[model samples]
Target: MNNKNKRLVIPLLGAPGVKLTDTTLKENLSDPFVQFKTLYKIVERFNPDGIFPFMDLTVEAEALGLKIEFPENDNPSVREHPVKNRDALNEIKRKWKGVSERMITFIKVCEMMAKEFNILKGGYVIGPFTLAGELVGVNDLGINVIEDPDFVEEVVDFTTSVIFEYAKALLETGIDMIAVLEPTAVILSPQQFREFSMKHFKHLSSELKKPVIYHICGNTKHLIEDMGKSGAWGLSLDSAVDLKWASEIVPSDVRLIGNLDPVKVFLQGNPEMIYEKTKELLEKMRDVDNFILSSGCDIPLGTPLENIDAFMQAAKSFK
Candidate 1:
């Protein structure tokens, strides 16, 4: 048994971090290469099978001419909402050059890592509605969806195409998977999810033949069926969702991951508590197969390493 070609064994993790799109880390995202390098190190330390690093939130909106302001400590935030009018869409180039220095640099890191380690190479990207949120602002996009249906549809479709193309490019890079993060979709009613979010998301999933993971940070119990229907291979849930009920809702064919309280338990709980919580959840999953253990959301950066070790210890024990 040679070591180089070996497939490493590791458990899934709810990738943890600060809300970069909020107020920290944004200052450094201006240089995508530096951003990728920084994020990769943190991910490599965790040693998960794959990771969606911090570079996800900015590229699409920034490319679309949104005024992105970076702060010293956080991920980049959108300074100017780009979709004030339909004309602004032109600012985003339709063709993917695979040569955008910023975009290509991220891929180069993945290629480099794939050469060195068997770990999966991956990253995140804003979903259509989320990207649209950066464009029209969250409240404004909601208003437009009801007030101007045709315009919202047009914008969503355009953004959806870019999401698909950009993600398609990443999947072709020999990486294991890409998480299509449609965080805004969590706010929609389940019906709205079926109508607006699921449609394009389904299309996006279909176009990317590689595995896709969807993370909607909310009580996603009501939307699990739609998630299954959307063609995503897996769904990441917030801690608010019920684990037992979710296992029943998700189709057996599609793997369901998560609902650990990332902040309450992982951030504040002790290792024994972490072990207890993980043991309880894993027991709940006893009746189901195809479930990957994970946190409901990104594990807080300050999460106790002991708790993390305890959680992984439980996973490694799984037969």
Candidate 2:
């Protein structure tokens, strides 16, 4: 795998039926061995440049005592918002037990992946602003950011502390990259993102021992320049972003990792369509040296394995 020749294929392929089933998601997330087996199957199947550890966004919130609802067929989601004010936020911080308690299994999974996989093994953490939204309802957080900027800052600061502690633990596990998932930040204006999210992103990027991949779902054309200022080594965009435009705006050093429509081509379409779309995207991004071919977001549950195979084959077949 020479660096120049390597066309990194790092799609989000850890959904049910891509390598495992809903049963695996239900049982294996808490068991390190099961998690490893499931992840190994995915890596063995896709042979991606990097493989993600289970990317359940609710794990941190769950660790913080927020209730989560794990539906049989979908990703688990936070069901409750526990932090209502500064006092409640402080109280949760006081009782914080660090990543050792709830995230230990996830940490162990990362360790196992690092020990076994020779390629890139990445770990995921929910971004501070998004995690803050999980703690206090997103609507409330949005209102507070406008009405009481100080209160919003306090909550985001608390969430950043929690994420930093967890991130340090993940890095200690020897994972090659850390991806900060910040889907919640897409709703904010570019200025608001710089004020609320960029600072924390810079802080985490500075503290990380490895490169940080900043991921934000939905339209982010408005924030591309500000995202570059976050100090992240990579920027992962969702399906709505125009990759060509993003590649032109960001510095050459910042790697651009995605824009494929996971649902349209990978899930609903057949292998031929997958190959065509993958090739189209590769050609669209052909001149961008820092581009890495990948799904815009996590491959949805029930996406056919053959479609993923087509995705990889298409990337490989391209010059």
Candidate 3:
């Protein structure tokens, strides 16, 4: 509720250049020192007052044995489906390397930044169900969920344990909070959300001991209340969502972040359009002390710098 504690402030993020994308393999992203140092430079310049890096998740799905393919210019996208069936999916156990290349790089990134910046530094972990989906293919995971709820639960729980150790590694770096990117949670029904996503997150929430933010990047208006109960300190909605409405609907104690249409406004639109949307978002959030302005998701790779600058001007225009 205190915007002054920029640590508590939720500002904007990007997919790659704008937000940290999980674009590396275990080999590349693990050493986040240089990358994080670069990120800190951006944070220092942007001066969002607080900092939340690009949501990067390397260990969660990797430990489960999914092969990741890193692209040259863009963020890493998931490449392989490791789990052949329910049996193969449930074979995973917790194999944690909090300080692996991608993992430790990000960890050290957080540690060094936390020490130097007084920034509310933190990174992301892919949630269990999504991780499971990445490993087992979304369609396959869904099929398993219907045919083998208990089997799916086991994998989900196993995936969550990996996220737990992965998160602790980030915290060990002395980061402020954890952003649990639950991107795939959007595909589940309310019932499925409870069965798979909710329990898995609640388990992590119980163990993490720091402020946790839950983000599902889609029309999750139906799941907002359910999401609020997950014990996260904040809730970040995508650009397709309405931030003011989320503020009204979500409990006051839980901070609300985002809803900026990153692509339509920031990437493709002109500065005036960006400025107008910026002003409109600021006005919408004027009365609310707990909201942070941000793009619906990460800034696309090609977004103009000036469009993002307009949002910064809007943030500084607090009076």
lDDT of each: 0.67, 0.85, 0.72
List the candidate 3 regions with Cα displacement exceeding 4 Å.
4-9, 14-30, 57-59, 94-101
| Alpha-carbon deviation at 103 in model 2, angstroms | 1.1
Deviating ranges (above 4 Å) for candidate 2: 17-22
126-157 in candidate 1: lDDT tens per residue? 78888878877888888887888677777788
Model 2 gets an lDDT of 0.85
In candidate 3, where is summed lDDT lowest over 10 consecutive residues? 18-27
Query: Which candidate would rank higher by lDDT, 2 or 3?
Result: 2
RMSD of each: 4.8, 1.5, 3.3
**Best candidate per TM-score, number?**
2
lDDT of 2 by residue, 192-287 (tens): 999899999999999876799999998888999999777888999998998899988899888998978988878898999989999999999888
Cα distance off (Å), candidate 3, residue 77:
1.9
- Rate residue 274 of model 2 by lDDT: 88
lDDT of 3 by residue, 1-319 (tens): 3556442334555333333333332223544654665566567556665676555544556555567666554666678877765556545443444435456556776777788876566678888898888877888888888887787787787778778888888887777888888888898888899889988788888889988888898899778878878888888789777778878778888888786887888789887787788788877787877786767776766777677777777666645
Q: Model 1, 62: alpha-carbon shift in Å?
A: 1.5
Candidate 3 Cα deviation (angstroms), residue 283: 0.9
Runs in model 1 with CA error above 4 Å? 1-46, 90-101
Q: What would the TM-scores of all predictions be?
A: 0.83, 0.96, 0.89
lDDT value, residue 190 of candidate 1: 80
